[model samples]
Target chain A: MKFLDFFRSKRPSSASIAKERLQIIVSHERRRPSTPDFLPSLQKDILEVVRKYIQINENQIKLSVDRNGDCEVLELNISLSDPGKK
Target chain B: MKFLDFFRSKRPSSASIAKERLQIIVSHERRRPSTPDFLPSLQKDILEVVRKYIQINENQIKLSVDRNGDCEVLELNISLSDPGKK
Candidate 1:
């Protein structure tokens, strides 16, 4: 039984569960309607900066902010098109 | 050896890593300064609604939004004080 268990997938840990919950909650928090007016300009500026290096669609760039306690974190994710083609 | 391996602590799976990374990124994304202007009022309203049922601090209530593709999710978390205490 123990040997069989070894081959089986491991159960998720409490830490993993907490992480999943945090992610869902945080993602929801970022969608608030009160988003700053500067966000569009910031996104545009970042898009321009990234465009200089690679080809990507405006939709491929994502930016958001998150807060934990007193600390605020800025996040950016950019997806590039086919690298070989360029 | 297989039995011994089973007794050993399980290694974290890729899903766990993804969850951790997502949690950090999502938490960071939620801190944007552009938070809705009505959020405070909304929080206050929720606090009042919860207060009627249980005792809790303003900080104990949390709310956020998350978007996946075209779908937007609203999330709310509330922490209650001692349950037995009056």
Candidate 2:
């Protein structure tokens, strides 16, 4: 099979190229449609932990478990208001 | 060029497959490296409009501008608390 491939142009497989693109786009997004039941409780737990760092309310945080290939990424975004503004 | 393609099995181009995958993942996430200057202001503005519908703070809403090929998608997720829970 290696010898036969040489007869064609030496371009890398398109699948690999697509894989790279897929990785970039999916890095922040979560896969699957079903959301777990523990999410509310999980949010509560995170709020408790984050409170030590900054004064934030329940509305200021988002917790998502994103799956990429074999690994899962726990993505947390927290918004802090600027002290200078108000 | 056209005649030579017939000798090969009719597999859809890898580019199209990657494109489909990209669409699925990127539907929710934003693109580009630089966070736009207007985003903070935009979120503030959206918060005002959304306040009319339901009681939510800036934290409960996520606004993203995602680019799919030539078009752009504005994705927003607003978390509404379940009244029955508490």
Candidate 3:
């Protein structure tokens, strides 16, 4: 009976379950990336530079971040409105 | 003797080594980043513009040609080395 009681006591409790949930939440937050501080200024500056050459608004610029090996690649794509050329 | 033979067989064969070396050399020049003629001037212009604000080198900027479904995507990546810190 004591051995059976020992095995029952070894089972995870509500506290342990709550701790596990907390750990999962922490890990999930670690994996999810937050927006960078310079993102707004960088985007604004890039858009400004692009606008100098071609007429494009902030909405026209498409930005994407991709990973290659250990390096992170930030790609900025802008579509031009060329009337004569296809 | 079986254990000794097992340890001896752990070494890679010469043919496999040669194949690996060849694979590395061949793959080094494999993905030719063939791009448009205007790309050079565009990059130069963009870099010139970006240099006004950020002190970034040419290596920090990565340009790759990607094909997405039907349209060919031109990727431009500028690595901001942690804005506040060096």
Best by DockQ: 1
Point out where model 1 deviates above 4 Å. Answer: A1-40, A84-86, B1-86
Compare the candidates by TM-score and give the number of the best one. 3
Model 1, range B1-86, lDDT digits (tens) per residue? 32223222232365532211111111211222332223234334434543443455546555565554222233345433242135
Predictions in order: lDDT: 0.33, 0.32, 0.32
Off by more than 4 A, model 3: A1-36, A57-86, B1-39, B49-54, B66-72, B78-86
- Write model 3 residue lDDT over B24-65, tens digit each, in one string: 000000112331233334445555654554456655655555
| Tens-digit lDDT string for candidate 3 (A19-72) | 110000000001113313333354456456444444455454556543322223
Top candidate (lDDT): 1
Which docking class does model 2 fall in?
Answer: incorrect
Q: State, as a TM-score between 0 and 1, how close model 3 is to the true structure.
A: 0.33
Query: lDDT tens digits, residues B1-86, model 2?
Result: 22113212222365532211111111111223332323334334434443433355556555566553422333344444321122
How do these models rank on TM-score, best leading?
3, 1, 2
